[model samples]
Target: MYYIGIDLGTSAVKLLLMDEKGTVHKVVSKEYPICFPHPGWSEQSPEDWYAQSIEGIRELTADCEKEMVAGIGCGGQMHGLVALDDQDRVIRPAILWNDGRTAKQTEDLNQRIGKETLSKYTANIAFAGFTAPKLLWMREEEPENFARIEKIMLPKDYLSYCLSGVHCTDYSDASGTLLLDVEHKCWSREMLEICGVSEKQLPKLYESYEVVGTLKPELARGLGLSADVKIVAGAGDNAAAAVGTGTVGDGKCNISLGTSGTIFISSRKFGVDAHNALHSFAHADGHYHLMGCMLSAAACNKWWMEEILKTEDYAGEQAGIHKLGENQVFYLPYLMGERSPHNDPDARACFIGMSMDTGREEMTQAVLEGVAFALRDSLEVAKSLGIHLERTKICGGGAKSALWKRIIANVMNLKVDVIASEEGPGLGGAILAAVGCGEFADVEEAAAKLVRVVDTVEPEPELAAKYEERYAKFRKLYPALKETF
Candidate 1:
């Protein structure tokens, strides 16, 4: 049997075809436009996502035996607000996870409802990127549209509905909506009342690997697939990425350095940080995981190399950087505000401690180190919660850089394991599909058999000591600038 994984991303929908043995048969990607109607606001059409996904799936399975495709699963961008009308049509463009238009709404929730009370209800404080705040923003600003909402869906759930004709979401994805009682694994009635929405408006939640429904006949026929193709409720992007890296059992860890950076730690037991610095969410593996997210990661390097430096040669620029912790310049990676520990959307990126002698290479190195240092901040929070991590599997576009990987390992003082395949969430989605189709006994067995680590980057004590001092200074820069940011 074969399984399909659909990664509904912010910029594109990527489809992957995998056989029962875990080999990737084919992969296809289709791009779509991301709209910004106002500053700090990001939106995308649900229709565009569906259209691209369908096209991508056709291209992905073009050469294969379509009847062999047993199941389909999705790993999607989380916290996007996608509402449907009475007729099941998209009410408006989806508000993306990166959208920061709900600052006022987020502040209102934290202040009026109180952070303690909010955390008690949902195990998380309000953030500008959370779905509940976005819904609140729409309710207050666009009451007409909010009034017409019949179904509230996340980005990938919308695709799931289009494919399977089932209005459902996975627990991993629902955990981010701020409408879930994450600790209890159910919808929070208090949160629903506060948002002025009812439980009926939400999709039925399922464990990430559970089969939700079969593909719709029309969708199956259009893709040259059978109507019996099962659809599994997949996870949010971070959890899916964790699964892809085999971070399933207790004490396992995975670090993703994509547009956003995340430190994902899996645990058999559920735990929430006292300050809510890390997200306490359901894992794709039917347990629990804690995640700390940084808004900007690889994008910091992109901004410096492309927008400011006016060069597309990222490798060429990075090649000039040799001195790691010796550089005097420091950078703060908060370009798109921040999340996790800080939770400040007003925070801005800064390059501090620059001098006349500061060369281009040093500044470039600073950008890389800045991201690593910021990631370490989250690691510190996890440490405070008594979740000590010795090593972490690294994935994402930024993880491609050997220098960046070394920097991360040394800064965090942990062994950074590089996986053989770094496909992230898309691959994880396929793995979930395989499990749902009974290709494997369970998530643990599937992950243990499929995921392989190609190499490990060990931290040198000397380099770790240097970064330790640097990190001390780096930690202070944020607090010093907090009042101004």
Candidate 2:
């Protein structure tokens, strides 16, 4: 039997087909538009997501034996608010995870409702990008839409609902919504009340590996698929990526440098940072995990390479960056404000310490090193909590750059492991689907058997020392410029 994994991302929905032996037969991607209606606001159409997802899945399985496809699982972008009315129509464009228009609402939640109370309820403080803040924003600014919200969902779960005809979400995805009781793995009733929503309005929650429902007869027939195809309750994108990388069980870590960056630490016990800097969420592996997210990681690199520099030759540009940590220039990778420890939506990207002789290579080196330093900010928080990490599995587009990987390994002073297949969340979703269909006994078993670490980048002592000194300087700039942003 075969399984399908759907990664419903911010810009594209990537579909992957995997056989029982964990071989990916075909993969396809379909893109959708993102709208910036106003400054600090991001939105997307859920209808477009559905359309593209179906189209991508069709293209993904076009040449394969469709009858062998047993199940489908989705790992999707987290924290987008997708509200539906009584007629099951999208009430508004989903406010995305990177959207920063909910600053006022987030501040209100943390200050008025109290951060301690929030941490107690959801194991997290309210952030501008969280679904709860977006809900509050809708209630205050668009009362009509708020009143019509008969159902609320995260982005990828919306895709699942359209496929299975069952409104459902997994715990891993729901964790980012500010509405789940993370420790208990259930809805936070007080949070629902605070958001002016009811428990009934939320989707039914399940562990990520659980089967939600089967594909609808009509829809399955339309796609030349079986109605009996199971739709497994999928995880949020990061958790799915963790599964894909075999970053399961206690003390395992995975670093993702996609559009956004994350340092995910898996654990068996439920724990929260006293300062609420990192997110304490349910893992797809039926455990708990801590995640630190930076709003712009590879996105910062993309901005510099494409929009600013206007070139596609990333390697050619990076090739000139011979100096690792001694560059005087610095860049703040806060292109979409920030998340994790800072949680400041107003934070903007910056470049400091540029000299008259500072060439393009030095500035570009700052961009890569800046991202590495920002990632260490979250890692530092984890270290303060005594969750020490000596190494982490690295993935995403940024990890493909050897120079960037080298910079990160030394900056964070940890071994960077590169896996054989860096498929991200699509592969994770496929693993979840396979597990749900009994292709393997559980997630850990499947990952142990399927995922393999192909290479490891070790940190050099002298370079690590230099980066440690530079990181100390990089840490001070954020505080000095906090009021400026």
**In terms of TM-score, which candidate is strongest?**
2
C-alpha lDDT score of every prediction, in listed order: 0.92, 0.93
Candidate 2 deviant stretches above 4 angstroms: none
lDDT of 1 by residue, 251-277 (tens): 999999887899999999988888888
- Name every residue pair that clashes in candidate 1: none
Query: Local error of candidate 2 at 128, Å?
Result: 0.7
Tens digits of lDDT, candidate 2, 1-485: 88999989888898899888888888888999999999988999999999999999888878888888899999999999999999889999999999999999999999999999999999999999999999999999999999999999899999999999899999999999999999999999999989889999999999999999999999999999999999999999999999999999899999998889999999989999999999999999999999999999999999999998999999999988887878999999998899978999999999999999999999899999999999999999999999888989988778889999999999999999999777779999999999999889989999999888999999999999999999999999999999998
Off by over 4 Å in 1: none
Candidate 2: residue 475 Cα off by (Å): 0.3
Error of 2 at 293 (Å): 0.5
